[model samples]
Target: MSPNSTDAMKTNLGEAGAHLKNAATDAGSAIKNAAHVAGDELRMGRSAVKADLADSALAGIAALEEGGGAAREQMDQLMDKGRDLIDSAADLIRERPIASFGAAFAAGWIIAKLARSGDR
Candidate 1:
């Protein structure tokens, strides 16, 4: 080959090699940046999941507390109703002693039978 042609060919090969090296370096840097961004996104997603769980737990606790309050109020109302029933029965017994006595005996007999059956 001519000396000039050989030199030109050598220069072209060297330029091609440099371009390939630069491309490899840029590819490596891009891969590293992508990995870092993915890691940060994963951590943020985990934090959001944890926060959502905590909020759900708090909401469940609040619902349980509200249910307990309603139960307590119902119990208070039942006790008041029981007190009224007793007062009315007492008034009836005072007005009619003989009839009240007979009714009380019948109720006692029925209660005794229920207790005996429950024991079985």
Candidate 2:
């Protein structure tokens, strides 16, 4: 080949190699930026999920507390009613001792009869 042609060819090859090196550098930088962005997005998503779970757990605890209060109220009402029933029964027994005794005997006799049948 002529010296001028050889020099031109070498110059062209050097330019091409520089362009390829610049392209590779740009691609590497783009990949690194993308990985950083993905990591940030993942962190944000995980934080959001944790916040939602904490909120849900608090709501559940509030609901359970409300239900427990209602249950306690119901238990208090049942206890009051039981006390009233016992007072009424005591008054009735005081006013009619003989009749209460006869009724108790009858209930016992019926229970015994039913128990014997079940045994058979």
Candidate 3:
């Protein structure tokens, strides 16, 4: 081969090698950037999930507190009603001792009968 042709071939091969090296570097850089983007997206998604879970927990606690307040109010009302009933019973017993005693005896007898029947 002529010396000029051999030199030209060498130059072409060198240029091709440089281009391949540049392409490989670019591909490596692109891969690294993609990994960083993927990692950032995952972090953001995890933070959003955590925030949603915290909100749901807060809502659950509020619901429980509201339900507990309602139950407490209902219990207070039931206690008041029971007190009133006991006061009425006491007044009735004081006004009619004999009637109350007779009624109590009848209630006891009926309860005993019901118990015996249930056992059978």
* All-Cα superposition RMSD per candidate: 3.6, 3.7, 4.0
Considering summed lDDT, which 10 consecutive residues are worst modelled in model 1?
A: 1-10
Number of the top TM-score candidate: 1
How many Å off is the CA of 119 in candidate 1?
Answer: 11
Model 1 bad stretches (over 4 Å): 1-16, 109-120
**lDDT of residue 48 for candidate 3:** 100
66-88, model 3: which lDDT tens digit per residue? 99999999999999999999999
Candidate 2 CA-lDDT value: 0.98
Off by over 4 Å in 3: 1-14, 84-100, 110-120
- The global C-alpha lDDT for each of the candidates, from Candidate 1 onward, is 0.98, 0.98, 0.99
Candidate 1 versus truth, CA RMSD in Å, comes to 3.6
Candidate 2 TM-score over all chains jointly: 0.66
Tell me each candidate's TM-score.
Answer: 0.69, 0.66, 0.62
Q: How far off is model 3, as Cα RMSD?
A: 4.0
True-structure RMSD for candidate 2: 3.7
| 1-120 per-residue lDDT for model 2 (tens digits) | 567988999999999999999999999999999999999999999999999999999999999999999999999999999999999999999999999999999999999999999999
